[model samples]
Target: MTAMSLGPAYSRLWTATALSNLGDGIRSAALPLLAASMSTDPVIVAGVAVAGQLPWLLLGLIAGALVDRFDQRRLVVLVDCGRTALLAALTVAVLTGSATVAWIYAIAFACGVGETLRDTATATLLPPLVNDADLERANGRLVNAEVAGNELIGPPVGGYLFGVAMVLPIAINGGTLALAAALIFSLPSVFAPAPTSESKGRIWSETMAGLRWLVRSRRMFTLSLLSGTFAFVDSMWFVVLVLFVQQILELPAAIYGLLVGIGAVGGLIGGFLAARIVRLLGPAPTLTTCLLAAAAGQLMLGLASEVVLAALGLAATSAAFGVWIVVARTQRQRSTPRDLLGRVTSASTTVVMTASPLGALVGGLIGREYGLRAAILLGVPALVIAACLAYAVLRERREPAP
Candidate 1:
């Protein structure tokens, strides 16, 4: 398929992702607020955050193997359906006044499992749907859509809805999952079967092979490590941001949503412009530059005292990270073989995701011990380390002439 020919399918996929991600963003804010409303302990609220991501660390490999062995579209549909059902159940529990933190934790874990399945399948399915030449563009579009959904639409809506009724965000999240499932069902049947493997091997053996290849590739290894570090530091910011808004800046509850939404504007712009930037600077330079920009943004956030200044810094950081994500993901998608894509992506996701809970734990502890400002300032080093790693791993390279 030529790049132009792949446009329609890419559009369909991007739309579905954007819709689902909006729901994800709503849940991201709502869940924590729900926990906070129920309990005053920072540790417990952080635990809710940790539970949501725990599946990625534990079941990611298994999820990848399943994506490789089954129909990717069916897996996506099933996972989406499962999430919808789970969220609906939570909504019922909340409406009945029976919802507890434990219930939230269980639902969060289940949703995480579904997310793992959907993500692994999507990563594997994308390359085959688009032409090789269009992979970068497709990735950029998808990333941009995610930014719009998660950063732009979801957070602010979640805060407002939570103020009205806790069940509202959960219901909305459920509805979106159902819609996403319907979209997945409409995907072409070409993605039904896994690619042929030369050797018939057990799931464990195949999983090991995938992990080995990822670890053995110098560039892949470095990317995975940097990505994991990035996830950790970013998660720290996530945990502290709300507290910072409420406690330090003394901003209204609505500002949390507004600031996050504003920051998402950067992601939207980055996603839209990623392809052109890639063309101009080539992938390596683009990746390195964005990482450095993200580091600078994080540092600025740490230094800023005023809410507006902090939001600006965050917006810049988010935009830079958005572009960096597009560049790195495109490079990985272009470089990896189709058959190995699911496994490798899952492995990388597993590593990076593991860092999130750890970062949350550290952030919670640090915030409890010191202050939100201090906890946030600690993230600066992680960003710096990530930038340096990217620079070391991805040196300058010539761009292909159009």
Candidate 2:
């Protein structure tokens, strides 16, 4: 919330995430809109999203282990460079008049692979860069940059840029990613990841080592499980909301960018306050509140008969998630062993996000079969119940559950 510097290195890392996520916002908005033009079918549009998230399922563990076994700084830089190249290629495809839905899907998946690798390494890098006491605050600042850059400014900019020309946003995305890599390159490598004692085998076996560690930790495992349920529901909400915005709420393309931008404003607020809230309420209550807020937001979105109601609901939902990310990631960072941080973070991310593809598919089906409102309305109770369960789990002072 304050301008208190997080030191020069963290400043660079924070800037990199913020700058890259701005491009992320542009790409996410533009890609879906581009897909919509290529095909009106919700399923095809949904598939692009599925492709984007599929790497978490397919490569999360392998990537995590590789991150742990290699130089984290280089891993992040290489991934950024790869993402930059992929965006450049996508821009060319669009300009040459040869872009297709299939090309979008392929490019999205490739970029996602790069993202998964970068995120694991980045998560591992933080603990070394900052003291334990500052983890939550640092996480908040990082997230604030992400929410503002990606959501608040990026989406709106992307939507307007697309109106100027399809190539406009794509060109900018590539440039931004290149900038991010350069910023990251400015940060020194904290240290090389020390190989695990039993790290003398194939990567899959090495990968499962992290999952096994996660499953063995009752607190981490339970929290991840609870979060996954909401993530699944949230993905469904996301898909249906696009249709809800255009078909039901009747917002046009540019305004859809504004709608996402509004939500990001809420996210920025939440991210700014995450550290203070977590300190005041403690981790359990902070997480419990996030779940309840998310449920309320979803209900508002489902029941809204007007644009303002839906927009407010979306803003609330995004704010809740922004708060949730700060609290949950800090807790994990504090609790996990430093040696296993990359693997554990990756494993948890994989578990929580693994539901998104399914959510995309199911949300599309529910929208097509039952209608968009039904798709959204169906998940409200599940979310609330998950909140209750998360609270109960976090509050348990007794021995950890097996």
Candidate 3:
């Protein structure tokens, strides 16, 4: 399906996603740079990163339950506005030279709360806006926008802005988030999630319901595990990646952003091709391929001795990640009941995101003690296990009972 065929609502959502993600990319790159400059301690730097994701582990389930009860569109708008305000405050802190590692950590944690809420609400909000049949294509387009803004354009711009002034990227990030909030607020109220019986349940019960649903479904549960594994490895690799590029690869900080942007090129290509690949090869085989490809990419990255080879490895890994996300998310959306989408998405996200901080901590310690390359190499084994799981679980076609 063409982009236009997805309707104006999806387009608006897509645009807003891109805008916010652009800001996300900027902040993501800048935060690490800021932390690294302040202290060369890998664990300290990783702590800054870890704080941002900790909310996912702490508040993820509660946020999901809340999303199911509220107006999802409004929730997203409010969350974006909150994030904008948070960044604006951070900008001020940075400008006044009052920003300490602890201050940055607090702000990152608050923003991550917004991220958790906004993500759950958006996943629940999308189904009403697009046709079920176009779910994969629509998801792919959204992924495309996310990669373009967060990875391709955001990183390089953030890196440049950081060199100009530390506060510039943070300030600009707030502005982009503000714009994203406005866009989301503009959408019609028809975008609201339909109320269901679960809405009346207690928060704890409602949260449990989502977990129960996921556990009952072998496919979703398996996929969630695989996703969590991938998240762990990805987080580990990225936490130490800045150090790798600077110390091991002998590249400047500016070039690090460029390398991430190059990796995004692969993400963009994968996002555009995901739906088509799923159509051509079917979801199972396609997912299997993505897993194996990611494993290969990680292996290449771990073993690379030069910038050119490292870039290729990053690109290949990103491509696999992009496609895997679209396919897996599309499948989840398709399999899930509409009323439970928010909670289910939250449960899944919580599971996946919980791995991130743990991975970050491990990566930091390992990178500090062993080597940056050793930290990256850790992902190779995880990906290989994930690939094996994918093949075993997803390869067979189960015919429906007549």
lDDT of 1 at 199: 58
lDDT of each: 0.79, 0.83, 0.83
Please give, for residues 1-402, the per-residue lDDT of candidate 1 as tens digits. 222356666666766787788998899889989989899999999887678788887899877777777788888888899899999999999999999999988988888788888878887778777777777778877887677777677888998999999899999999998988887787777776554754555888878878887877778777788777777877787788888888778889898878877777877778767878888987777777777777777777777778878888788777877777777777778766666777888988888777877888898999899888777778776676667777777763422211
User: Candidate 1: worst 10 consecutive residues by lDDT?
Assistant: 393-402
Model 3 root-mean-square deviation: 4.0
Q: Give a tens-digit lDDT track for model 3, residues 107-165.
A: 78888889889878877767778888788899998888877876677888898999999
TM-score of each: 0.82, 0.84, 0.83
Q: Candidate 1: lDDT of 88?
A: 92
Error of 2 at 196 (Å): 3.5
Q: Predict model 1's lDDT versus the native.
A: 0.79
Question: Rank order by lDDT, top first?
Answer: 3, 2, 1
User: How well is each residue in 181-298 modelled by candidate 2, as lDDT tens digits?
Assistant: 9988888867586655775657888778778888888778878887778778888888877788888888787767777778878888788888888889888898999999989999
Candidate 1, position 379, lDDT = 79
